[model samples]
Target: PGLEVSMTMLAVDALLDEVAENRAHIGLAYNPPPHARIAYRASSAQPVVLLLRKDHPLAKRGGPASLNDLQAYPLALMPSTFGIGHVVSMAQVAANVSIRPTLVTNSLSALKRFVTAENFMTLVGEFAAYRELGSEELTTVAVAHPLFESAQARVLVKADRPLAAGPLELLKWIEERMPMFAPVKRPARRKPIR
Candidate 1:
């Protein structure tokens, strides 16, 4: 199999443009806008959730967290330029809840690190912290809001352009594995046995 692939990370707007303009063969994005030249091949619901250390006080609640609950914590958030941040901004306004984050950055790693090293929380798409969740270093609390219910992870391609063998193959491969990336209802925390 002679397949070559190149991956580039872009903000949601630019990522959609790359696929629509045919600069990139395929794009994976969170809640991309509708474009005449882009088609969604597949999508998975990836709701916005609260990411914090497993032992954090909120995690002890063992249930969905309300946006207002965030007011009590030191919050770290991505700027509104990112998809998750934009959704969060809209949800905050719609719910009439105000959250003042202590730190704002575009870096996911920084957000993860801040929550891990300090008593801070960040809101992000559930899939964004897939690894940390798997390792049980962090856990997610579903945000109790309607706006967050529709966030999606999508596979996109040019509307009319047919993919060549390599890109098509890669697209098929990604489609088959999409469900693995979808959000799972995290189980309640279990106490450690000594």
Candidate 2:
């Protein structure tokens, strides 16, 4: 069969649910539920970074600000349903300081647009803001805290089905390019029931 890929965006729970239902063949996500078989590919030490406009005060003062330092400014945050939200929540508890963002939205584009024009900030994975960061439209400072030390990213495939040659090859190519800090063992293939 000629190879074609379909992509859709969903929150972690919904994404895994679709995978479990065999509605999707592959997914890229962080800390997906363990019930789904996962091929651990790479880890990122700074999964969450504070994103600010290039000339924002914090951006001007900084190289990796602590959560307390971030608390001094207004924030724009994703709702708790997204993975980044959960990470920030954990960091919040660990730091014992409440973060009350001036704006909260699930749309990354909304956060991107708002932060560029306002004195607000938000947290996102480096990949999410890769282009903006490269263009100097935004500056990212890692949240220097133990709770946000590192996060692993993995590829998920359904265990009930054997991966076809095309998809398998694509997966391998992705693994090769991933920013894996160190080698991680691939998930074992599930044996077909006799």
Q: Give the top-scoring candidate (TM-score).
A: 1
lDDT comparing candidate 1 with the true structure: 0.86
Whole-model Cα lDDT of every candidate shown, in order: 0.86, 0.74
lDDT of 2 by residue, 118-167 (tens): 88888887778888888878888777876555754567777767777987
What residue runs in model 2 are displaced by over 4 Å at the alpha carbon? 31-46, 159-161, 178-194
| Candidate 1 ranges with C-alpha deviation above 4 Å | 181-194
Q: Tell me the deviation in Å of residue 117 in model 2.
A: 1.0
Best model number under lDDT: 1
Residue-by-residue lDDT tens digits, candidate 1, 1-194: 98988999887888888998889999998877678899998888888899999989999878988877878899998777677777877887888878789999878899999999988999888878889999888999988888777898889999999999999999988887566443456799999999
Candidate 2: clashing pairs of residues: none
Q: Candidate 1: give the clashing pairs.
A: none
